[model samples]
Target: MSNPYAPPDPASRPPKQREHTGPDAPSPADGGPGPGKAPGRQGRAGRPERPKPTPEQLASVSRSVLHFGLFMLAAVLTMQVDLPWHLMSLAFAIGAVVVGVRALVRVFKEQIRGGIVVLLVFGLMLSGMLVVTTLGSLAVWNEQMERQECLRSAITVSAQDRCERIYQEAIEDRFGTIPGG
Candidate 1:
């Protein structure tokens, strides 16, 4: 019975070459790590061990997180509240620029992957959502205010009821009609 784990015939096996042996042993010739060379003595696949990033990369990554956070906050506020669209857009733009610049600088300095472009693309996509949300919120607020103005001039209960229904219908048309209404 053949031993599955056994080396295929010792005579057929190439003799094990010791580290740094004969003239055929690797040298820095031809601009590459030659055969039989372990780039880091114990590193896998003869690859030189990677060095850890400097404090510069760490600091820049932190700043990028902060800028991204600002963009998220602005996006939420613009969508939920009645704030001016321009103000929110300005905040979003600044956040995108700051984060992108920091990530790009780090990319060039450190030569890393998934840098500036990813963050910028995310920011722009959310910025577009913010615009749509702001328009929706503005329509809701306007409808409410118009109802209030109409009710103020209304002399009877029926007039006030009519004013409320008109505003409600207008809001429902712009958005979808509320469930259970």
Candidate 2:
């Protein structure tokens, strides 16, 4: 009666232990073999490989924030100063153009599909901002210009009135009577 699960020849069983004698294997001083170099020399060997953000990635984030912030700040400040809104809006548009170009360059350099999508979206947003700022500034400038024109007209009318009174007085003195209109 033999057990079904038993080995056919128990006397022929292989040895349980195997010896490691490779140069890559860990020395006795550093415990058994493992991934990477020995513990004490790990620091001197430089840091282990790690995933890190590339320069393009860092530039992408930094530039995006900077352009956006600059646009907003310019928009707000334009309202407080007496400078022409058209000029402020033009500056904003130029800034957006610069950001768009930078984004395009980064997309090409990084060659990342996701990054490209993000940059494109940002470009669209910046473009829209440019348009809005430009239009808004134009409107403000037109309004201010109209007001200035109105003030100039008023000043001209007043100056004409004063000149007419002086001319009447000079004519009366020359003729020894009031000048008739």
Query: Which prediction has the highest TM-score against the true structure?
Result: 1
Per-residue lDDT of 1-181 in model 1, one digit per residue for the tens? 8898987896787777556646665565533355666544433554555566678876776677567667667656554433444356545645655665555566556655464557655765665566565555555776866776798799999999999889879888888888898
Could you tell me which 10 consecutive residues in candidate 1 have the lowest summed lDDT?
A: 78-87
Per-residue CA lDDT of model 2 for 1-181, tens digit only, reads 9798986786677755444557766664565434444433433235443335587686775677467557645654564544364466566656766666666666555554565567566665765676676665455554445444455555677765665565445555545684464
Query: In model 1, what lDDT does residue 34 have?
Result: 53
Superposed Cα deviation of residue 48, candidate 2 (Å): 24
Number of the top-ranking candidate, with lDDT as the measure? 1
Provide C-alpha RMSD values for all models, in order: 12.8, 19.7
lDDT of each: 0.64, 0.58
